[model samples]
Target: MTTDRADDRNVAVVTPWYPNPQQEWAGAFVQAMVEATAPGCDEVTVYHNEAWLMRQAPEEVEAAREAHRRLLPVALHDAPTVAGARLMRLPVPTVPDYTFAELAQQHASWLRESLGGEPIPARVVHAHVGLRGGWTALENARPDARVFVTEHASFIDKVLEQPDSRDMYEQVLDRCTGFFAVTDVLRDRLAETFPALAHKIELISNPISFEAPRPRPVTELRRWLYVGTLVERKGVGWLLEAFAECHAGDPELTLTIAGPGVLAGALAKRAAELHVDHVVTFTGEVAPDEATRLMREHDLLVHPARWETFGVSIIEAVAAGMPVLVTRCGGPERTLAGIEDAVGEMIDVEENSESIVAGYHRLRDRFPDGLDLAKGRRVLDERFGYRTVAQAHYRHWFSGPEAGEGAASGGEEA
Candidate 1:
């Protein structure tokens, strides 16, 4: 499938977070998608979330500026420009951030101004998430500009957790052009709420860069690793409980957790209560290299997330040829299908000691000597590898609107 329109088609890829050297998996897939899609098109440009820009340190900020300079083709826009191929970063004010509603409104105004007098000839405006950047795209992109939104996780879920933001979420969803849920579970839930856009929805799993599986030497002590935000939804509490049960029987077992969130103190307390604090290590947030090193060293990767749209870490572990024990939540279940034996096991999200112990026993029984790293690696390469997924996306991109219609058929309710 090809488009003569391809040469004229200018795409603006927008995201709220982007991975840097300091924070590896923080929107790392966005970086991969832009790099992959940009080269194939006549022009591809990227826009960053200015709200997040304020949180970085001076050096990190400078590093991001330099990265954009080297990688992206266009510049940040004071106002939108009319060009055949251009990447324009929408300038958002650093203050008066009252709420998500306010922020979206501010962004909508900025997007309108960015386009200025120029008509947006954009065939597609691909947004990384549905709420923030996606809302802005829906608001300002030319009516004909198809808006595609990828829901990485439940930003709405996060908002609903706070008593103040529930109404604001409804507004955000209403403005989305088409929704992309990372997992079937998320898609179903969204479909229940917005049946009108249900047919417009699609399932797009996050992609991983497949590497030749490097098997690590069988470690003397079986190490387990968990990487993600140290938050409630990640099921850190459940993981701690499960780890405690598993470690009680096997005193030599060790666990390492990476990433930062507000639940750090609560998780620490839970660990102490379970009396597994001695064996558990929390590294807060670490560099990507360090996270990968820990994954390689570990015998199994445990992700007891209560809810996940897609667990990129599970894919990363599979790519690294390590087994993963994930909850039968959103993302992990989708990724673990078919390759259940070699990669890892999925436990119930109950986060009980029995469930955790059972999950461990399941892993031990399936690969009593430990998983075949080679087999695990092969699974990831065939299914989740970036090149394969990228090709799928490229087909979707140039194939035009009807492609999405066919892809949307037989779509399960999530």
Candidate 2:
């Protein structure tokens, strides 16, 4: 972290979510951003601040905190740096159910403790979420460092509704050098939430890397894939019902549910209840690379999430050269705006499977001729490809020296 390095090439990423042994699917886009932006920079370090909540009784909380304070030093001594960046895993032990503002304070305090009360030794710091990550960066970043935050949490509405959390978020918005949202839906939500700070927010899409040509183009839409957490919010139940209906007509049709969540067993039982368990496969959580491979093997990606701030999986599927049948959740509508007909179908979000079944039929009728997978892939690549996203980040972070130095006074135009 020497100043002799190229200007604005030394960057630090502070994030509450990251791929770890406990949750491999968490904060994958944050890792992608680090990997994509790291190549162009001289150095990148990621400080992953994760909470290790204690389930002990109220009377034992103090003892647990003391034990954690003693054990953390030994734990961090042999921590490994993974992937393309120098990773520092900062695990904070605490009780669960704290409000967002209180939780952010704990996260920031842990980061400062890890650094021995010293400021983060980087010129630019980018955090994944506003509350804990952005607030952590703002608290620890050097006086001259340019700090930025990207809002990507699906539970952001809950976080902002609380008075304490909203006040803390406003402070974070006021202090950071710049802020970005992954999609127009998220940007609009943030803008409307704080109209005075609306001008400071902008768009920065998640990056995707295109793979080699598929061995063969999809001639038929038989194999369906869903790659995400198996949660109620993801509409996994609706997806399962729709799959059963589709499979009844076409016995050859199959569905694969990837990723892990609390609803795995319930979804499995529901599949059996629908009598489609034999045709469905549940492969629990997978590494990011394996998720990509799954996309390559399947003909279509079916993401039936009730909502999304930014649907990274939908873009990843398209990059893998697979068409998608996703819900018109907030993200997919904006991400697939003009290319709806070219990619696949965009059905409305619903509790029942009727929309999904009808959309599947409509997409099936279009088949190979009516759809243009290549055009969809090209369009998304130009927008979300690694090169495109990394450059956009650099332009905002290092376009001028004034931007880096004016953190307290509000930096140069983004």
Candidate 3:
């Protein structure tokens, strides 16, 4: 199962988003994966999708500039220190109202010039997300070059909203040599959509590097921390309502929401309307280190997401020795299942005021002592640590059958 001179093998990690100083969660996983695979890899090149060039909005331009500034330090950090890891910034603007075929053509051209013309050939292309990066990876790799795709979320829901990307999902699947899903729920859905590619789909959870355990005692005034984008899909509005209800009886209860998104203004208004604005504090988009620091101050981590590919936040919380309250719609539920202390009591995804209130009450009654941070941290170290998860991925993507179990193969149409 071991490849001789593994450090000599080259891999190109492709993604649309990467973390900058502002702490974007784009290629964070890819960065973690490369570090884990370093022992068995010679070099890892990160190719980012610079589709922001297509954005003409003044606001988007400002955001892009900020993102670039934040990313510059990490980009430079990766350049020299990390062995076998390189960052390649490719700015490929989206075509104006262009179809996937047209977008693919533009991406292919970018790859031909940026990657295809490189002095050294890449043995494998690993893409995060399904459509754009995956399409570009397939186009850039040699015919027999290994292509691995990790489905982080449901792009079909996002892209198929437009008529042009109607068949984009299938096209991307057809080109991938193997597909990786963050949750079994997503894998099953993908299997149904493209049965022909079902066999190639493998369920893999997000890898989290375990942090130092921080154990806090359960107290009367429970501190609940919600970290993620303050958007509708994250169920922040409902969470606020529930918190208001909880605060009515227990005024000591406080909810700290970290992260920024389009719905920030609405969420703030909703908190005021619910009269819980005093109890809820918004610390817009903190860095990972700061987020972890905030997590340490809280007793519980509540993730009321409507949909998620994998809840890296949950894993991060568990690693920090915190209990989680996640909705049953996405990847976090599965990660919770692996931990005995956090199983069976997931929040309902319906995520209305009633459901949120009910979930809060249920948790309050069940674990008044708060979740067992030690047990949760143990679970994270055993199942989702970056080293173990990355090794699993390396076996699945690079070494073939001899590495271990081969991911399911073949495609099934939905």
Candidate 4:
């Protein structure tokens, strides 16, 4: 990265969750945007506030606080580099279930920490997610600098349910320069709930580019794959029953459930009870790179997620040209609408066992020889690849007054 191209196009990206050594996969896509845009823009400063304390048990809070006290960066030398971007960890705010005002105050302190009493030279302060990060950007962004937010939280449904959070979120939207959404479904959902801010909302989906490292082999197992956590909401239990339904049709078929969660033991037990234990393999929490490789190595991706804002794994598989089976979990339908069915498929999330089993049968019957995944890679890259999305984001960042021209007015589900 020559500083020449980015002369003064400094951007400060703030997020409440980011990937760290302890939580390797947390908010990784946000880091991807930071790295890709850094070369095109002058400089990128990431102020990441890891709020893992909220997930800790009540008795473990003090111990977890001590661990973070040892980890949070208070100076630039101690700042870490992730995916070619400089990252500084800010102290986490108080849990918002109790109070939103205190959360905003903590974020105000974090913005001051970024400046060290100096004026920020950022051309734009972009925040990912809502509330605290959004509040920080809204308060500290230079008057001339732009304030943009890219929201990806699934908890927006709950946020809307609360009077205080909903009102605060509306205030956050009203004051910001622009808002970005990952999926059209979410963009529509936001527009529906906050009609006043609907015109300010825009669509800029997440980035994904697959580079095959090795020649992936075609195995004879006729495998069915699931890449998300083994959680109840993810419907991994439904996946087991669905796979069991498919297993009876083809004895040669096998299932691989990657990624770990609290339901791992129960899922394994259910597989045994289905008498398909010998056919099911449990891979606890595969890393992103390894997960990408697994997508190519396997015959198909069976995603039975009950809920998703946007399914990254689906694009990953489709980008690799692998066949996919997804459920209508808010975003999958919109995602698959762009891809060819020979390369992917979807089922009704409500009728999981029957629909997924039928979906598998459809994959087997239709793609008897499996899909030519590499065939669709070029098109997928042109649309959702990192470089393309980053360039689009860069244009929006620097567009200034012209930015809101194409912003969605009716919040069309585009």
Top candidate on TM-score is 2
Q: List the residue pairs that clash in candidate 4.
A: 6-42, 259-285, 260-285, 321-373
TM-score for each model: 0.76, 0.94, 0.82, 0.84
The TM-score obtained by model 4 is 0.84
Order the numbered candidates by TM-score, best leading.
2, 4, 3, 1
Question: Top lDDT: which candidate number?
Answer: 2
Candidate 3: Cα lDDT at 383: 80
| Per-residue C-alpha lDDT of model 1 across residues 373-403, encoded as one tens digit per residue | 5676777677767666656555555454533
So what's the TM-score on candidate 1? 0.76
Model 4: residues with Cα > 4 Å off, grouped in runs? 1-7, 52-83, 93-96, 99-105, 111-121, 217-221, 338-340, 368-375, 401-414
Q: Which lDDT tens digits does candidate 2 get at residues 1-414?
A: 323324466789999988887788888998988877887666689999998898999999989878877777777642434445788888977687899999999999988988879999988999988989999999999988889999888898999899999999989988999999998888888889999999999999888877555777887899999999988899988999999999999999999999899999999999999898998999999989889888888998998899988788899988888889999889999988899989998999988999999999999998889889899999998999877888888787765645444331221222
Q: Model 4 has how many clashing residue pairs?
A: 4
Give one digit per residue, the lDDT tens place, for model 3 in 76-127: 3235324457776665655366765567666655656654354225666788
Model 4, range 1-414, lDDT digits (tens) per residue?
Answer: 222223235688988877676666677678777766776655678888655336667787768756644554543343646445677776663443554545665676655655664545575788987676787777777666678898887767876677777888888889888898888877888899999789989988788866552265444338778887777888778889988887887888888888878999998898899999999999887666777778778877888888899888888877655778888898777766655564666787874588887777776666735554455566667767877887778777765443342322211111
Model 3 whole-model lDDT (C-alpha atoms)? 0.69
Candidate 3 deviant stretches above 4 angstroms: 1-8, 53-84, 95-104, 116-120, 160-168, 215-221, 338-344, 368-371, 401-414
